[model samples]
Target: MHRLAVGINYPAWAGRNYRIQTASTVVSGLGNAAAPIATAFAVLGAGWGTAEVGYVTAARTVPLVVLMLIGGAVADRWPRHVVMVSANVFNAVSQGVLAALVLMGHPPLWTLLALSAAGGAGQAFYAPAAEGVILRAVSAEHASKALSVFKMGMNGAQIAGAALGGLLAAVADPGWVLAGDAACFAVAALMRSGLTQVGGRRESGPSLVHELRVGWREFVSRRWLWAIVVQFSLMNACVLAVETVYGPVIAEDRMGGAGAWGTAMAALSVGMVASAVLMARWQPRRILLVGNGGVFLFGLPALALALGLPLIPVVVAMFLSGVGVTVFVVGWMVALRQEIPEELLSRISAYDAFGSFALLPAGTALAGPAADLLGRSGALWACALTCLGLAAAVLLVPEVRQLERKVPEARGNLPQPEPATSG
Candidate 1:
């Protein structure tokens, strides 16, 4: 096995970016880990009904859909480092407020919704800026490998944070987990403050609406890009529906309970970490082909659960599915980074995010009802079938398959990218 050296002399900026990225990954992972437990406690421990929980979760998506593009625009207009730092700081404050509320035994549904909205807004701003900074940090030739490294760090943090959150939720107060999540954000903000902005100042942009239009155009121009987006949207809808509701329901019935679900999730995370490490060493050229092909296996866990497979078989399926997701994510990021211009990269990235995530809430909302009507097993099977179909659909695009033919150059004379206006 050949070890690929990062190659470039470690820039002072790279160190700062690496620290910031790592801290941010940890913080984001903590928040993600806390969310499920927090939401569960809000419903179970604090006496909030499922309807209220549904409302809060649904509300979070509104801001994500409405403000994500704006967040990208802000990242493009301001220094990426500044935007990221500010966003993290805001996130920390929001999480702190939520923790205080929960600890006080006054977890109002409205208050929870508001705090979640604030956090979503912060993410809208932070994600695009962070992605833009990553583009500037590494040379183009190393972009694919760099993305793989980033995924490894991000997924590794998610695994650790989620596992820690589960442990804390089991043994300690849920408020403690929320507080820890807040602390992670504070550290992320501090680390981000040290990063130097790359590529100098951005051009003053046209009206936000105009910039948004440009981003949309860039997004839709590529057949392969939109095809994957369509596939992912459908896939996400199916997966979200099953994973959010039916998977746990099935686990409770067939396995033990939430603990079993957590174990399966942890297994998935381990697989993701392994996949990221593997890709960092061996970047496939036809990323879309490789990614989508791998994604065909993503439905296995749901299928295994739907079929009432033994616990070990289900766990193994979950791990394999996690590997598929990692491959798909890394491949997608590399393709986007290589093809898109730096200026518009953040906005375009936001657009991609928006498109990919658009259906998630719908999926969540429908999952419970769908399970009620179709049965948990039926819903899980549906998700598996959808994933397989989507993967097959992505293979129809020639661009996705041919992307490997174009070896990425170190730096190209491509036109400066336009900033994203809408999220």
Candidate 2:
């Protein structure tokens, strides 16, 4: 009876955080599902080839990267919940239009790509605000546990969403799947309707440039932070680049198409679920070093794809790679929160987000062409080798290799400007 009650006790479990946490997980999970299907819709239905798929995806990433700084600044300046709600609404509208077109008939490649760019713009604004909102929802002491749970929900959603996306694309229609995704964003926004504003307070700064400069200074001051960012940037550019752009297109030709790729994606999400559950309960020392080291495994899935391995073996590689991504997610968030002041958290997070995905657009742009020129296997070999080697090289940096988290005495002291009261 006691365990059952605890399981069902939404009120006392995590206080005001329950609502926002649920919403965030939905947002992340649905967003993940939508992105890949959106790509497939452009490729399979709209008749975009691999190169066009890469370019269309890059169209979304370009605006996201360009506008992240402004988004972070806005997040720090306003109520995070409000910012998030606005962003989700934009996402709903953008995707809703795309879904409508896809349902009507195959939209032109340009139209699909343009709408994708709109969604990316919304993502730019949402990412920092959502991070800030979730960060403040839970008590500081339970940060890792809360984030882990949040990630677990996202992974769970990914399992369902990715598989569903593939199944729909294979059987029904990707447009129908996209429509569901838009509805999810709407539902997510509704869920966040009551989340108390936690971002009203802002550090006293003269101007946006001044604030950004401050964020930049704070970012560079932490050698460990910058080192990890540098590591991920290279990894994304060289290896993840190949995986994201090339993997799907190749699967369409070599494997069974969207459904097989989706199953593989679901397998990856299953691995992430394991990672989230473990990280939620265990906060490790030297997380930065340990996490970064684990990323060496992340390149394996693409390597398997490159090697022309069987589906089962490729799925296994993806599973390990998923685990590696979660390790980085946990380590990076916890370490950054522990080290950086709350007021500047969003901005700093933005910088990290920018850096982590900094080269993604460039990589996406080049990946298709590179694969065409070098052969998919040759490109895969180059990417896999470069990522694994560079990630290992980051350990040579003393700051990243030796960093440890020291818990703050008052961890949950960040402002909730609206003084929220749980009913």
Candidate 3:
């Protein structure tokens, strides 16, 4: 009876952060499920051409690139929980607005685009604050484990969200699904309100631009960090182009329709969740090498599609790609947590986000025309070759191999000392 009680009441670990992590996972899962279905509905109901849909999706990147540094600085200067809650509120409003617009008979494309941009701006702020909270919540020794748990939660949420979104879309009006998404954001905001003050106090004196420059300097000094960013920038561009445009087009052509595309996407999410769970249990020693190596595995999906594999096999390939992506993402987060200073972590993270995602819009916008010229299968093969090349190039850098050893604090929840040298 005592043992049963202990199992129910006491977690295996100590820290409010773990509880916060769990809350985050729930919120993320609910929100993500709503987002994709809303997006799917917008595409199907609004009579938005492929190019217009791409444009709306791509426009979100603009704010991330432009205001992300400012958002990071705000996170550094304010209580991270406050920032997070506020951002969630903003996201909730945006989703609510989108739902209303859609229910009111599909508003103009420009209006939908504007709302997406507004939500993107909110997300730019939310991401850095969330990272700051994670950094502060757990002890240094537990950083890797904490990050692993966080990644697992996020991927799990995405998987659930995708599945839910698909199911919801199949049954009822998409506006209702979007409304539910807005509710999830509201709940997330409420949950964040319960968190303890995370950022201690605000820093004094420096202008936002000056702070941003300092962050840029810190970001550029790390060879492994920046190298991975560059590699992913290219990788994201390729993957987004294919997934957003070509993959759906192909699925529509071969497998019958959007439902099949949703299944493939859900498969990818499942793979990611599986990968994150594995990494959480078995933290890798050689972080950079392992991360990049896994990223290279994304090529399999592109190759499979290009080779005209059957639906089942193609789904398997997508799942494999998801696994690789999850590993790479968690590994990179672990590396970042180890390498960067907590004080500047948000700002640096913002820079990384901005730089890595900047090209996504261009990739999506160009994919249609490129597919037209090269053919869908041919374009996918090109993406596969490019990803493979980028992975190989990243492997050649000595810094990627050496940084793992240099980061001694990556294994457990111990408090980290001040960094002696910038990465």
TM-score of each: 0.86, 0.91, 0.89
TM-score result, candidate 3? 0.89
- Local accuracy of candidate 2 as per-residue lDDT tens digits, 1-423: 233222233422255655665656666576567456556644666776777777777888888888898888888888878888898889889888988988888788889879988988998988988777666665556667767777788888988888888888888878878788888888888877778767785666568888888899999998888887877776877654655567777778778878888888888888888899888777777878878866888789779988899788988988888888788887877776677788888898889888877887888878888988999889888888877887788888897777776763234333333333333
Candidate 1 residue lDDT tens string, 164-188: 7656655666677788888888887
Q: Per-model C-alpha lDDT, please? A: 0.73, 0.77, 0.75
Q: Which residue pairs show backbone clashes in model 2?
A: none
Error at 148, model 1, angstroms: 1.5
| Model 1 stretches with alpha carbons more than 4 Å out | 1-15, 47-55, 198-204, 248-257, 408-423
TM-score of structure candidate 2: 0.91
Q: Choose 2 or 3, whichever is better by TM-score.
A: 2
Off by over 4 Å in 2: 1-13, 201-205, 238-240, 408-423
Counting only residues 3 or more apart in sequence or on different chains, how many pairs clash (N, Cα, C under 3 Å) in candidate 1? 6
Best by lDDT: 2
Write model 3 residue lDDT over 1-423, tens digit each, in one string: 223222223223435655764676577566665475456456656776556656766766677667778889888878888988898899899989988887787788888778878878888998888877776666655555666677667777776776676566656666777777888888888877888787766557788888888999998988887887888788888887766666666765677555666677778877887887787666668887887778877887788888988778878988999899877877787777777888898998888887788788787777767777888788889999998999999887788876662334444334433322222
Q: Given candidate 3, what's the lDDT at residue 250?
A: 70
Candidate 3: residue 366 lDDT (0-100):
77
Relative to the unseen true structure, what is the Cα RMSD of model 3?
6.1
Deviation (Å) of 373 in candidate 3: 2.4
